[model samples]
Target: MTVAKLAAAPRTAVAPEPTGPVLSCAGLVKRFAQRTAVDGIGFQVDAGEIYGLLGPNGAGKTTTIKMVCGLLDADAGVVTIGGRPLAELSVRALVGYVPQDIALYPDLTARENLAFLGRLYGLRAGLLDERIAEALELTGLSDRDKDRVEAYSGGMKRRLNIAAGLLHHPKLLVLDEPTVGVDPQSRHAILERVQALGDSGMAVVYTTHYMEEADRVCDRVGIIDRGRLIAEGTKRQLVSRLGEKDRIDLVASGDLQALAASMRGVTGVESAAAAADRVHVVAADGRSVLPDLVEAAERSGATLTSVEVSEADLESVFLNLTGTALRE
Candidate 1:
């Protein structure tokens, strides 16, 4: 299906040249009564780029996005878009936000919902109609535009929610956990659409707990945890921070701690630990130490069901930095 490209904003007769990132947040800090939800987090998203905020729940991703959208005030920070401070009303219009929860009215048809939201953005009749049509087409929901939200599948509802965000032709799109719960197919569709949005020149900030999703869609990633941005860079850059270590995950049933301890003593093993039901071994060379790990598992009476070896990936990098898995 062909999605219509969003028309770029019209140039004035003598418009000022633009420079810097389309969206930038600096020293963002937020706190509740007694807890700091976000702490001095900062990053930038340029035009036509996808920046993923990779973190687990309670990692401060939501708080940071809320501050960027002006839904919540940051205890300290500055957010800017298109070289204009977010405090300016005009700059707010340049951002589109899609939250984790479905935000459409169940009784309204997708067309009706889009029209209603478009009007809130001051879109006139003709422009509103064009935007509704374009948003539906962009989200692959044109044929089903007349369907009521209550009658749509979870995926359809989610797409409609996104379509609502695009009604005003935002330059930067912030999506928070947009793929939380859905069939794999729907999740795939949502991810594909997000990537398409970036390719079409919209700067996108995607936040997710899924490491694989970040690897798939992000041009760069900022990893957040415990109210702080612990690391920020391209996947390659982040992985490179781990040096030459390789990650070996041994999925075996038995005394995993014992197996981990035994493997840790191997000459090439850098570190070993047991988490969940797996023994995670970091080594200078996983391939060279695989035989030792296998022998250790056997000696510990752990039946080896599977073994996965890989250099540092986003997941391994996260674990190394945070001392916890993303899924945890």
Candidate 2:
């Protein structure tokens, strides 16, 4: 598989503008034997929207993603792309999926791998070369296309895997943990390209357990846990819905209960509770009330070790709703 002359691609066929959501799923459920891997998961992703499925490992993010991509059958639910049910084989062509695992032949050069995969997507010889070149360029791998996959860095392979997914120019892209196990630099590069694609009117469903990744990249987020979608909204909307304010972690030795009591008495504090060696405080204004909390702690004979204050964010919202951390 070789492109002797990599010329500029001819005018690529652009997917038609979506009249409705690019992807929609309702009451999606999947079970493997006795365990239900996905339960009642539903969401919508519009053209140019990057919807993130945020959950920890085994939280059914991947299972839900598979169902959305039509790669796995759902036990119950309906998925529609562009107002058509997923049962239509032709509609499946509207989606490009990149699984968590790298899907590439180790011995094949980047160009060779893409050429082979493009053919599988039914791209003809002339259009195939153009698509491959465009995909490589989008993934920042144009210069390395001649190199074998075995010689590419983990990040490069990840990017190349993404490039292959884009070869046929699917309107909706589903990526499962695209940055997992990648170096920070490469992860940033991959994320940048995903953002670019979203900007170019491609709908994207991205799944990740990394809190910061979801926060940084997603236009809206669906928080899934125990195989259920607990919440879905923009970060701001989710946090606002939970009524979370600033969160402060007051760490001290002595009696944490006493520290918590003091914190609870602070005027701006919305709530305070003692968990282990720390006192968690929610306040309308954390910084403004920190001085008072410190004084109260000192008066209660609790020596303050450290104090951390952060405005309301997805982490706090997740903790409030699920009673656990997002990564856990």
lDDT of 2 by residue, 81-182 (tens): 877888987677678889899999999999999999888777888889888887887777899999999999999999998988888878789999999899
- Candidate lDDT values, in order: 0.85, 0.83
Please estimate how well model 1 matches the true structure, expressed as its whole-model Cα lDDT. Answer: 0.85
**Candidate number with greatest lDDT:** 1
Task: Give the winner by TM-score.
Answer: 1
Candidate 1, TM-score vs. the true structure? Answer: 0.89
Worst 10 residues of 2 by lDDT: 1-10
What tens-digit string does per-residue lDDT give for candidate 1 at 107-157? 999999899888877787877887888889878899998988899998888
Clashes of 2: 0
Please state the error at residue 66 of candidate 1 in Å.
Answer: 0.7
